[model samples]
Target: MEKYDNIDELTGLYNLNGILSHLQGHETRAAEGSIVIIYLNVMNFKSFNQRYGFVGGNEFLRGLAGEIKGLFPEELIARTAGDQFIILANSLDEKEITDRLTMLSEASARHDKGLRLHIKAGIYQQTGDETDPVIMVDRAKIACDDIIRVYDKSINFYDEALSKKNELRQYVIDNFESAFKNRYFKVYYQKEVRALTGKVCGYEALARWQDPVIGIISPLVFIEVLEDVHLIHKLDLCIIDMVCKDLRDDINSGYAVEPVSVNLSQLDFELCDIMAEIDKCRDRYDIPVELLHIEVTESALTTGADFLDQQIKKFRQAGYEIWMDDFGSGYSSLNNLKTFDIDVLKIDMDFLRTFDTNKKTPVILAMIVNMAKELGIHTLAEGVETKEQYEFLRRIGCEKLQGYLFGKPTPVDDFNRAVDCSFDVCEDFSLASYYDRIGEVNFLGNTPLRDKSFEIFNNLPLAIIELQDDIAQCIYANRAYLDYLSSLGFASLSEANSIYGTTNHPDIVEFTACLKRAQVSPDHRAYADIVTNGNTVNHKIRFLFDSGNRQAFAVVSRNTSIHEESDTAESLRVAMAHVFNQYFRVDFFDEDGTVDNIFLNADQKSVSDYTRDAKEAVRLYSEMYIYPEDKERFKKFYDITTVRDRIENTKSAYVVDYYRSATPGDNGRMQMYMILPFYYNGKWKFISLCRYADEIRDDDLK
Candidate 1:
């Protein structure tokens, strides 16, 4: 009856109290040779119980105890706790003990074929230095806990180094509350840059510890300690508050502010209402949701899927962007991408660190970027440290970049001062939106076309140019386009811009017509055959985007090799040119209302000698050519002061006005005049064209 109370009812082994009682009586025997205390712990035991039920778990533990007793027949053994056992062996030979333990593990696995058991042991050698059995057991358990996550090692030996480490961990745990209360932690910001422009687009907030006694502690150490104690959420929340306050200060000081992202540990969600806390901070500071981002690691997605899914949906519904950090660093990255609605994939830096040695790095990175783009998710490459890496990432179409090459993490105040001196800070939120759109385009590589079938568009043997605004400035051109420009006797895109410098250039006029045709076409596409430098080229123009005064188009061109024309074709072409000359004329003006150039196709000698001043020229042309009833309206159409603003307000590339032709004719006929305003060479310019109203499509002008 007395012995029954000391034994575990299920396993028939001595319990914790019984083991301690026996060890207390045999302390003197440890003086002969070192007594080894082996503390055995079964990892993931709760998972096993959940999988197989309490009955099955108890049966497995009983069988496991029998195996342990058989392996150490002469040694004292006791079941100290659930899934834990203590072995008191009178030997110092580690190899012999390890072999017996290995046999015990093998025998248990053989008994339970379905579940593989993982057992870890911590060995402590006692030379009679201390007599307290509880302390000895705790030290052994500490050593075991150190290797709980390390699957490769089955045992850990207690040593002085581990002792000191445990001491520091305890110190951090003891001082954490006071340290946080006194504001010993500081938040540092690392800038996220736009790959193409090298401009600061956002920041990632990182926490740093500023301990008074230890000076500075690495996050690796303190963060691990906090996570071990389940106190990491405090630090994370503290950092968030600091970042929000700093942003509020900057906004009040009239400094340009960008979006800031904060990292949330997995424990944060499990411990507290993280989203509500973040929202509280945001509302307190009055920060826009667009200026705050949330980041979660890929590993964090593996657990609490349903709960995290809800959290993610809540975050997105609240208008915050979610970024997956350390992408490709885990095994299930692709699956995570599909499972969650992530906005940005932060490619792990390890890929870039091993870029030179690992031949597959570049291939893997390209696939990730392309895959994310296809899924409508943006990509940001972290830990980029070299010019070569920057260029390669830019060429591969990475949307954002963050690394040491841009800048190291600094305090918010220091970062602000540095940005003021060296960085291009976006002053207006609208300008930030503009940069966001521009940054999406990769000038060094293939543009992400709207159609999936055109994935290989950039690889085709054709010249490609991305024209923007009404002036059709060559904002971006592929290598083929540059080569085509070289073939046309232009050394660079800048040189090629001379042809598009004036809106009245023949090519510009024709290009504008093609754009208008595209706007009216069902598919928003148009085709044209252009003759430049004695070469005929076929161009396929696709309209991409239009917002306010901004417009983008992709022009794909290929040479036709038809430099010479048949005699009949040449004659017809000349006859068409003669007819076009009789009907069309264009006038160009500078920002100051001065006429810069004129393209008068008709042989009109009377209107050839008008004054150079745009106002005077408009008055003379209106008086000489306009019908009496339309002169004031025609003059208003040429108002240089208001023309550009009107065109901009209209949000169209060109504006049109109707007037009657006053030139000598059999009868008065309605004529249309179009005005195009553009900025070039640091000045605003205007182009005006006159044509028969019947020849122009009314829908095309819209």
Candidate 2:
């Protein structure tokens, strides 16, 4: 009797109803022995399918299975799954384990024109501690994954976390593969609504991947891997060009869906001919110059100034718009604002996450909003998952928000419907669903209340939270909170009531303690004004609170969620500025005596890369000295004097213009920037700007 099923496709575990029945039938006469599961998967089988076609695929797999059955003398080998074989070794000598499995692999390779396949196998000695067969299989699979991820060929036992992680990773891999074939790629536009007047100012274009068979694969896996393989340029072109064509068709039809920003990775700039490609697409679709915006990260701006600046200049000359994406998401220390010629500066969702209605995240977002306002840089944030996060952004003078609170990234059809609907110019959305349904009637000892509480906690849309005794012991917040905390080096809530003082950061342990107290208080609030650790933020206990077991506080956030307007222009310059100013900047002296500033401006950040004021913008005047009237002029001149001079004088040490952006949005306004190189004090530096930005109009030009 076979111990496992034949058509199983998943990696980790398999159901054993068939095996149990087989065991039950023999219960009276068969002697019982331990169920030793020898799980083996031909490593890189997925890669194999991609490399070779089906004809070759079947020959190799079937050969391996035949070998497994023929060679193993003491165990029950079964075709458990695709490219994954399992054996129930009962009452077998443990010493012959390695030799038996190795022989099967060697025999498979010895076939005609065979591929050199490597295998990573997991061995689980199941003694049956109320263990389900499926769970046992999963344990073995996880052990295999653990070894493979770290590139180890050694055997692995069973670890619970490894199993769970393996399950999640396998799900991602399986779903992502299906996603690539289906229409998983899409761009969702959120209207950048002006909070004060409630006008449809523009839109922020967000990328989303959704597949019919696999559901949604978070950008975390696919986007990054694609970028590494230089496939992002294709994805960008597909999405951006699609937005451009859609906008033109919409405008021609009079539906009023404007041009918007499409996010571009730092790697996107490496193509060298990005501008040419964009221009070709725009012209092909008959799209106007006022309708495009190219945006990039701030760190990219500082380093990739020359190539990007050249591209931005071409876009500007051709009448395209420019922007700085992920503003306040990283180091803005050196005030690289002037270096890239940009129109909008996306205030990262991180700031919005920390915006406190009751000083929860604090109005610290105001600093960013006010800065953007003074500089004439438009501000928008993605990942605003709550009403509080949305409202705080608006109150602090921000004009846009995008998150689950507004709506998840939907398909083009769904997006079009939303754009034409009534939500054209408002930031208000709903969050009560994310919380407990307060109106539900509870009948049994507050069991309903408990259920509601858990529902709210488990479903708290954008963040991962940990609570103890009605107070939150820790929180793994969304992208927004992470960016803000990175500048302070206050990341990692693994430990309670602990604070680390980063370079150029003020210790906020005292503030952390107060915030902890508030979780249990009537108001449920606390406050802190800590500095970045060496100009970065880890943002620990930025607002840790214990919102009791009972539906505790009324949500301690300020980022008011907003509705998406399909037709608004989505610019990327703002998003670029957000990241550079908030999280990245590395000060390193070059041969010319200039700091060859290095920064890692990515679409996401790990918990560790926070706690310093972004690379080098000094706290004194860098944060608050620019007057509204002269902000643009001062920035321009500063970039020329510092970044420009360094690059020029050093005879190619650096250049003012280093990065490029090609963001697509819906405001009927596009953004791009140019960085000029210079040399200062025998050192190279960069200067940049997007003169076409709203922040740098004639009034601010000086």
For residues 96-174, could you state the per-residue lDDT of candidate 2 as single tens digits? 6777767766787764245467777787666567345666656666666556533436466665665555555556555
Highest lDDT against the true fold, candidate: 1
Q: Model 2 off-target regions past 4 Å?
A: 1-183, 332-334, 357-363, 383-392, 415-702
lDDT of each: 0.75, 0.50
TM-scores of the candidates in the order shown: 0.57, 0.36
**Looking at model 1, how many pairs of residues clash?**
0
- Over 49-168, each residue of candidate 1 has an lDDT whose tens digit, in order, gives 878889889988998999998898878788988899998777658898888888887888855647777899998877567767677888888888888755578889889988887887
Model 2 vs truth, CA RMSD: 27.2
